[model samples]
Target: MTGKKRKRIKIGDVYAIPLPNGKYAFGRIFKDAGIGIYKYIGVSIDDIPRVEEYQFIVGVYEYVLKSGVWTFVKYRPFKSDDEAFPPPSCIVDNISGEFSIYHKGEIRSATKLECEGLEVAAVWADNHIIDRIMGVDKWHKDDEK
Candidate 1:
């Protein structure tokens, strides 16, 4: 028999393992045995009991140049899906100049702002959404500083 090497698995990496029932089990590699085997924790995406529905108002902000003055305007508030998560504040894509909102690991909304000479911005979700994306509670503490 020819011996073939398998790719190494890392911790926190999601992977699929074949089961005896001819089905695949999706899980995350939690621990490594240093050998070829790895300890995996099963993940059931459809088994999540219930996710609380959260509603928030989002305001899109943009800078409009009228005459020779630049003004910032806060657009009307709009409702966002619970899955819409903002990108990290530090991750700014300079190439596309596009901002995206993600839902279920996919882009739900994308907007290309005109940033040639004007400051184009949008109010992402409320404080809760910002905190969830940033993985921090700084939004609530912003008032203290």
Candidate 2:
């Protein structure tokens, strides 16, 4: 055995993310690597935000969680009615900075205007996602130069 204990990461689990300004952001696991970072920024973990609101839903780089960068807060059951966990239908290519729509496993070209509010098709690491969430850096596919 490698002797490293694996933290149980499960669907419906919420995590407390610390921002540089002292406010906390929350992320919920909807599936393996699929997490929704909530739009609600709170003063502390005790301030539970509603699960319905979110800033971005992306496939997070698992290492960030595995390394304990984001602390587990609580678990709320995933619901059939939850709209925050939708698979990314619109995808932006990071290298080429192009946009596409991916739905039902099919991908097709999409205009930049059509990709509004969609994240680049890449797993977000800790710093990148946190900066985006904290408004330290704002990113929109159409704004890419």
Candidate 3:
């Protein structure tokens, strides 16, 4: 019997994977298993409505800065023609030299930690939220502290 050829996938590579519902999702390769088996965390392609080559979205938020403390009130998207602004995907707060991830308007205070860890956690949280909204399984779990 002839063997089927497997596609090569590498870590950090963004790919369009076929979903179970006969639709495709855009996933970023998270792990590379030998023999073409890979573990990926993907968001539905429909989630990213606007695709731009080089675009940065500036968020408009009402914040109060007093006594060196900044409190964010709400987030609003800026009007733009080239890109469609979605709701605030994630909020990275750096207060007192600690980073925290804010999801769905709630501060996950326990996640506050060093910058490196916070960065990873923030991305993970954002991806998790997007996947949830799109009805996809979460690819990563929060590391136990």
Candidate 4:
């Protein structure tokens, strides 16, 4: 696969990710999953800030960040089957194994490096949650049936 240098994304960076329905979700980086074979791209839920409420629904994405003043970076999906036990497709020395985020970026990147796991650890400790909108369902669950 073609690889590029991975960019370290910060909060406020805009991004776009594909939805299962063929649509796409866009938002800013609420959290970052330090460098690794893969990375997490956390986006804030429309009206929510906490990560607990809606995180399980959208889950973390495996992706690559694009270059330039673009929030909507193109990315590939980490096959749904890989969701259960996500191992880094390709990890750099300065990163973690269980990276988490809302979107995917950095599938194959050269800019990969190690990151401070403290920030991410704190977010997880808070049980970060994103609130759901009145009309939009964060995700589909079998219980909905």
Candidate 5:
């Protein structure tokens, strides 16, 4: 509500994530409610850098975006159909310590073994996710919740 309201977020829109250390990070909306966070750690680059400059570190459902925590940088469409992205359908809740698979508009419970070898989904927390990006905090398999 503070800054100018943006229209409904569309996929492929890149955004600037301002970090506290005076550095900046970048993320792109890849799908419904998900953004592929790039690997920038503490880089001081301000504007959205070229894709070759950073790699896709992780894909997450970032709630911060809904809260308007990021500024719209630019729209970068996927190069090809294969470029469309999102993590696995399996989501592991950090607060409830539950795992579920969202498929075909249905949500089903999943066991730890069922989620093995899959890119388990995660919701991006604000600073906590920033810590993860900065290599301070980490998400280990044992840390699954």
Candidate 6:
């Protein structure tokens, strides 16, 4: 028998692995050293790899070991569409106790801004959503370091 070299994982290769209740899951490979850890996310439980890497793209679904069910989740888009970043001139206006974010229009929310270019209304809409996933007061605490 001719022995072949093992294949290497890439950014978009999908894998399937066994799961509980005779089920399986699917996950894609992704590497991002910035996140510091690698794991499957959106795929099935059966597809997760028992290895180490920077970050792996996971499917937003999982296999139920006991019930033998597949549950799909509403996952955010894996790829970012925008390649350009806003200039540093963006600002959030604070007047007295009221805070308004002005981009193209007035923003009306109270969450920490990820960037300052998103309009007030857009930022306001994002605040609650961002807060639920990552706390409300999220910001760089150690920028000076």
Candidate with maximal lDDT:
2
lDDT of 5 at 50: 68
lDDT of 5 by residue, 1-145 (tens): 2233357677777777777777777777776455677765435434556653344334555457666777666777887644555545677888997888764346789987777766555455667667765667455745675
Off by over 4 Å in 1: 1-8, 31-145
| lDDT (C-alpha, whole model) for all candidates | 0.28, 0.74, 0.29, 0.31, 0.64, 0.30
Q: What are the per-residue Cα lDDT tens digits for candidate 3 across 49-136?
A: 2332211112211121111121111122324422232222334444554445443344554433333332232223223333443565
For candidate 6, the TM-score is: 0.23
Runs with alpha carbons beyond 4 Å of true place in candidate 2: 1-6, 81-85, 92-99, 103-117, 138-145
Residue 13 accuracy (lDDT) in model 1: 28
TM-score for candidate 2: 0.73
- The CA lDDT at 116 in model 2 is 78
Report clashes for each candidate as comma-separated counts.
0, 0, 0, 22, 1, 12
- Relative to the true structure, candidate 5 reaches a TM of 0.63
**Superposition error at 75 for model 4 (Å):** 17
Candidate 6 local lDDT, 1-145, one digit each (tens): 0111213323433343333335443333323201111333324443344543323121122112112232221122235323111112224455644444332223444445554443222222222322322323444345445
Off-target runs (Cα >4 Å) in candidate 6 are 1-6, 33-145
The 10-residue segment with the lowest total lDDT in model 2 = 1-10
lDDT by residue for model 2 over 1-145, one digit each (tens)?
Answer: 1122337876777888888998888888875367888889989866768756888887788788777667887877776634335465577777997889864346899999877766655678889889888776665654786
Candidate 5 residues lying further than 4 Å off, grouped into runs, are 1-5, 41-46, 52-63, 89-117, 138-145
- Model 1 earns a TM-score of 0.18
Q: Kindly indicate the candidate among 4 and 5 with the higher TM-score.
A: 5
Q: Which pairs of residues clash in candidate 5, taking residues 3 or more apart in a chain or in different chains?
A: 97-145
Evaluated with TM-score, which candidate comes out highest? 2
Extract clashing residue pairs from model 2: none
**Which of 1 and 6 is ahead in TM-score?**
6
